[model samples]
Target: MESDESVSDSTRPVDSGVTRLAYHNGSWINADDVCLSSRDPAVTQAVTAVERVRAYNGRLFELDRHLDRWQRTTKALDLTGLPSRPSLSRLIDEAIARNGAWLARQKEFGVLWFATPGTADSPTLVIDLYPIDSALIERRTRSGSLLVVTSVQQPPSACWSRNIKVRCRLHYYLADREARQTDSDAIGILVDSDGTVTESSIANLLIVEAGGVVCPPSDQILSGVSLQVVRELASEIGITWREQRISRERLAAAEEVLLTGTSCGIWFANSIDRSPLRAAGPVYQRLRSAFEGRVG
Candidate 1:
């Protein structure tokens, strides 16, 4: 695992061996040197699409699926700044090579890419590679985490970036802050306008009932890559899965609940609003084991 110690301040940019980053405009720079302009329209108005890819064994996992979703989101939003899959693949390869040493020293990391509709009437792309906090995952995996359903809900419009992992995240930030105010490990769960459960601040939620495992339909959620893997694993393991409208009450009452995301992987929820649950339920254990086997 990578050392948690901070890097020295006196090291030169090149000698620091920072992860390499590529933009749509063909600039290769250190990840730390990439900057976001305050005057840019995307920064000012929050017009951007994002995809977070997980890195395992020093390579990107589910890179194709993440790129597909990025393309779909860009097309849907009519945002014009994105590189082709092949181009992005090349950039990713370069990034991996540049960060090879750093990644080899780490247990896991995240590759976050975003494209913003040009502010000065031009195209721009932003991408970076960063290490995942193993401590957070350890806490979540060991005892589970708390989730609070927030009052703020997703908008109904299709162009609102509800289904995309966009950079417009003020609502999520606020909700997450509220959750943290209650408990440091607590995360916010957003609901729809009509009080239907949508997803968490950073992930998709899954519920295991007596009949089968249920996840909210993609119409209202950010259809996560990890969630897709979990679905496939469930099917392979003969666990019934479905897309349905899971109410907050149903989520709170579920026999087992898990959160899925690129970084989160699969994490059981210990409680919802102080309602405790069995951290190691049989169904959860089975699904977790299946997921681990496939990922391993």
Candidate 2:
């Protein structure tokens, strides 16, 4: 029921029958046992760099790539005290082991890693593991999703690039609020300063045309992990994938629109600005099949 939050949050409740374990600093702790100060810069300044990874068949999906971006982002923010890539892998393995039984029951799992500027001495690091709610995933996959273009255009990337995958996300929540006025379950589609379609509140946006699939340039969007996979899948299926400026009009008229992210690989948005729109065009169908074929 969570809207405007990360896709993982929308897919899993706080307690999804998994007594989730979270790794913080140097030890594993109960998810409920994890805490931070009210004044933590991660909160006060919203300066944390984050990465979300899904576990498939007990192993992280694209683990190295997820961690690599996380490292690059934290370094970009000049945040220190984060764990090394090797250390994070070990911690993730331990977390899965601690919740092995619960994890085994899941089709896939969510792991969120983040680092924050801490108590002036060092930074705070945390990695949380949660189970995905199959029911919610099925609903988004089966039932068509919707998007509404809001007046709240994405702030200029000159201020902060979405490429960093950080917590500077208040604007998204507000944009989603505007979208819900059109449809309760609708999400927001943000446009860049130049009026080019960028992304949705929680996922990267793609428009399928007769020629190919198009998404915004990485300089303007988050360049999500699922996006990379989908691009490769499209190539395999003989559908072109490219970066382009998608106007709101182009999106609404598109043969198909997709939102790619950690939570749902190629979720279709069947409507734009509350108007009916097509989804799962032939090219999207082929790309979806190719992408899903790899799931374990």
Candidate 3:
């Protein structure tokens, strides 16, 4: 066991060779110093909400949008002891400055915001930064990603609305693990109980057809900020965007499949469950170019 005294605060920005600083509750501290008790709800019950914001070109992308979603999720989960909006915003800026030297060396990175209901005293709020996996992004961009449809079904809305992003994602973990059993590089895509394609473990799925791009209804999947950006970009380019329930057969027949998330703005999918689909089709190429232009 480590002694609490050894975790004493540093007078200057703290760095452990890997991470620089982190915000815990209302104070900025060493990344490793942010700890939670084993009994905390975030650990014991998995009652935590998280928002991952990507910093592109050293600037946070869609920060307000990410923060809005985080607020909605924390409120839906009734998480308490959160900092006010202004305070949280200022802390984010300070965290970036604290990690400025490290961040400057990387092309892109991620800002993770975590909130959890705590013991009797207070809630847990933390902001941490991490480097993006450029190698993985490069590989996926070249060959496209394999999305394996997993046996694990998405939890019903009765459990919690799909709109609220929470840490209760054992299903996603199990699904991804099951996918890796088939192919080490495969990512898992969960389906509804009725066999409608919902989303991948960490991204929203978009299907391209002759008519337009189709997305899963908001009621069935977490509305991703990246997905919204794609929608806007598509509209600007005169591409139609619609929502519908996508069955496995439709997914197999899709002209192209795209994945959108905070870290990866847009990426193409090569196949699903070993059935090869078009990789980086014309639609995907155009959207990807547009996305890159937007980010740059």
Question: Each candidate: what lDDT?
Answer: 0.72, 0.76, 0.81
Q: Estimate the Cα RMSD of every predicted model relative to the unseen true structure.
A: 4.8, 2.4, 5.5
Candidate whose lDDT is highest:
3
**Cand. 3 TM to true fold:** 0.91
TM-score for candidate 2, please give it. 0.92
* Models sorted by lDDT, best on top: 3, 2, 1
Pairs that collide in candidate 1 are 2-105
Candidate 3 off by > 4 Å: 1-19
TM-score of 1: 0.88
lDDT of 2 at 160: 73
lDDT winner between candidates 1 and 3: 3
- Clash counts for all predictions: 1, 0, 0
* Model 3 lDDT tens row, 1-296: 12111111111332436556788877777776788889899899899998878777778899888889889998998987788888888888888889887776665577777888877678988888766667777666667888898889999999898998888888888888898898887888899999999987778899998958999998999999999999999999989988999998998888888888865788889988888555578888888889999999
Give per-residue lDDT, candidate 2, residue 209: 82
The deviation in Å at residue 208 for candidate 3 is 1.0
